[model samples]
Target: MGITYRRILLKLSGEALMGDLSYGIDPAVVNGIAEEVSEIAATGVQIAIVVGGGNIFRGVKGAAAGMDRATADYIGMIATVMNAMTLQDALEHLGVPTRVQTAIAMQEVAEPYIRRRAIRHLEKGRVVIFGAGSGNPFFTTDTTAALRAAEISADVLFKATKVDGVYDADPAHNPNARRFQSLTYSHVLTHDLKVMDSTAIALCKDNNIPIVVFDLSVTGNVRRAVMGESIGTIVGGLCEVC
Candidate 1:
């Protein structure tokens, strides 16, 4: 068997957890994701996950209504905890060893974010889910994924989205939008592509960690990306780095 990545960070948006529901968690979708993750873990690949909470709450939404930015961000952080807890349960139910670590100190529910402990868990074949969005306000989960990838020394940041790859335009909006099989970090910046937030792109570029953007809606894309299959858009560096 060929194991391409010894370790990787998988980023899942909160919307991905929504399934067919308009909002909130969907058990079936969460279970399907857990199943895929469990299969990938069986390959001996160290996995660290960063999950978004857009389905539950978006900080900007609260801020738009005159709420304090910091307070709204805290609410957003709690939303991530909810999502993290759900994912933890699903992964454990699937018989995959997992840990939930939050940026905010939450000793009662999950472990406090500790880089060393997280690394240890991955080394021991346990999946680590990072929540709370960098433990700070004004930062998106995409930035958190890049930060965690660098901190964990992951081989690549696998950005799981609904789309299979980065396109010249919003494929959903533009039928003629074309996907780029590969792109450099500079190219992404120059084009102002929407592959990730600017902060995330800058962090990945600085840390020399490549990113793979693929469709998590597909059943096996997660495992395929970790296996080094050409199933998504390769960004930041050459395919060899990923």
Candidate 2:
């Protein structure tokens, strides 16, 4: 099959890293994702990743409990760094060259986010993982994925989530919920699909970047997505007629 995308940005939620566990990272899940990413890297796709921190911390949840929003968000950013390192280690073990860059300055642990440097790493065939959620309290990793995709000029943004695709209702609760195969940017926002935050959606819309939302639990799906298999809902510009 022909590849649909050459350079892509992958958005992985920290909850996906936890797998069936209640919290924290699961080795098996991490290894599984690493193996898949390694396979894609070997296929010569320039990959950039933005990982979430919900497994360890959630700023919004903390704020709901009376904590200062910005402070809680900073902690959430740190949590993402931890997840990023874990992913980096996993990918490295699979013999893929990886680099972890953070929006926040963490020189001792990983390199700081630099646009040119990140693109350079991708050019050298190294998988670059971006963590720390845009170094802003209110911004989400979803938005970060959009921002980075725009910065690096990625061909597409792949959002690997627990669900298969965007549905009319919460598929977990509403068994009859319908999944959309493709949608326009306005449609995603007009209906509040919640596939990602509105800001992230708007960012992609402005940049004309396509977003592919698919289930991460399905093994080999990453390769399938990269190869343009019709496995998930496409948003922004991939739709022919939504």
Candidate 3:
């Protein structure tokens, strides 16, 4: 199949990198993901990634222990930086030219997030990884993904999750959970679907950017998603009528 998107934003949860381990980066898992990304890059899809920091630091967990909200969030952002570095190194080792940009402005390690620079990198077939959660404390990485997708003029946001698609309930917990092949922003909001956070969903709706939620655990799912093979539950677009 032909590529589904010319330029796409991929949202990868930190937990996905943990692999069989309880916490932190798993080199084997990182390598596996990097290889998948390389495959997509070879297919000529300009891929930009937004990585979460949950595996390293959870702001809610820190807040429950008396840590200040902003302080905890800053720590979480730092965790994302670490994760970005790990992914960048893995992608580079696989021969994929990569650039790590941070919202928090880490001049020593990464370039400050510049939209034009990022787009230029993508045009040159370089993967740009976005880190630091929008450089704001109150926002989640999900929201960051939406914002970045809009800013980069991405055709779609490929949300890589453990589950194959958006379901009415947790598929792992509820065997009878209903999977949605396609949905609209209204449907997601009306049913309070947890496929993405409200802020992120709202942003996508406003920007008219489509979201494809699919299983990253599957070896070739990334390529399939990028190829527009209907491998996931698509949400937030006029295509919901189809």
Candidate 4:
């Protein structure tokens, strides 16, 4: 199949790494993701990843429990780095050369996030994984994914979610929830579709990056999304990317 996106930024939530478990990373899931990534990279598509840390820790939840917001967020960012390392190991085990970069500095673990360096890695056929959620208090990994996609000029952003796509309501709760096959940026913002945080959607809108929200639980769906198949909800200008 023809690859529609020459380069893509994949946004993976930490909870995705949990698979059937309620907490922490699952080796099988990470390995499956790495295999998919390796297959795509073999097609000469450069890939970068931004991972969230909700599985290990969620800053918003901690903050809701009355801890310092900034400190909780920082811990959450560090959790992302751990997830990043696990992903890196899985990718490397699959013989995919991967680099993990963090917004926070930790020379012992990973290179600090440098836009130029990340782009260089992609150019050299290395999958670069970004962690640490912009190293800020309130900003989320969704925003980090958008920011990194823009910085790298990724052709598209793939958001892997548990659900199939963007819906008017929670599909689990409402059987009548309408799934959108295509959408505009403003539509998502106005309707509050929860495709991503408002900041993330706005950043992607500003940079003209198309986002594909697909069901990660489906095997081969990742590859299908890369081929521009209509297997998910596409946000942004449909004619351009979908």
Query: TM-score for all predictions?
Result: 0.96, 0.98, 0.96, 0.97
Residue 15, candidate 3: alpha-carbon lDDT = 91
Task: Provide C-alpha RMSD values for all models, in order.
Answer: 2.4, 1.2, 1.6, 2.1
lDDT, residue 200, candidate 4: 96
User: Which stretches of model 1 miss by more than 4 angstroms?
Assistant: 238-242
Clashes of each: 0, 0, 0, 0
Cα error, candidate 2, residue 175 (Å): 1.7
lDDT of 2 by residue, 156-211 (tens): 99999999998999989999998888999998998888989999999999999999
Worst 10-residue lDDT window for candidate 4 reads: 233-242
lDDT by residue (1-242, candidate 1, tens digit) is 37788999999999999988999999999999999999989878899999999999999899999999888888998899899999999999989999999999999999999999999999999999998989999999999999999999999999999889998889889999888888899888877888999899999999999999999999988878887899879996553222
Q: By TM-score, how accurate is candidate 3? A: 0.96
lDDT of 4 by residue, 1-242 (tens): 68899999999999999999999999999999999999999999999999999999999999999989999999999999999999999999989999999999989999999999999999999999999989889999999999999999999999999999988889899999888889999889887889999999999999999999999999999899999999879999653322
Better of 3 and 4 by lDDT: 4
List the candidate 4 regions with Cα displacement exceeding 4 Å.
238-242
> Considering only N, C-alpha and C atoms within 3 Å, which residue pairs clash in candidate 4?
none
Better of 1 and 4 by lDDT: 4
> What is the C-alpha RMSD, rounded to one decimal, of candidate 2?
1.2
Worst 10 residues of 3 by lDDT: 233-242
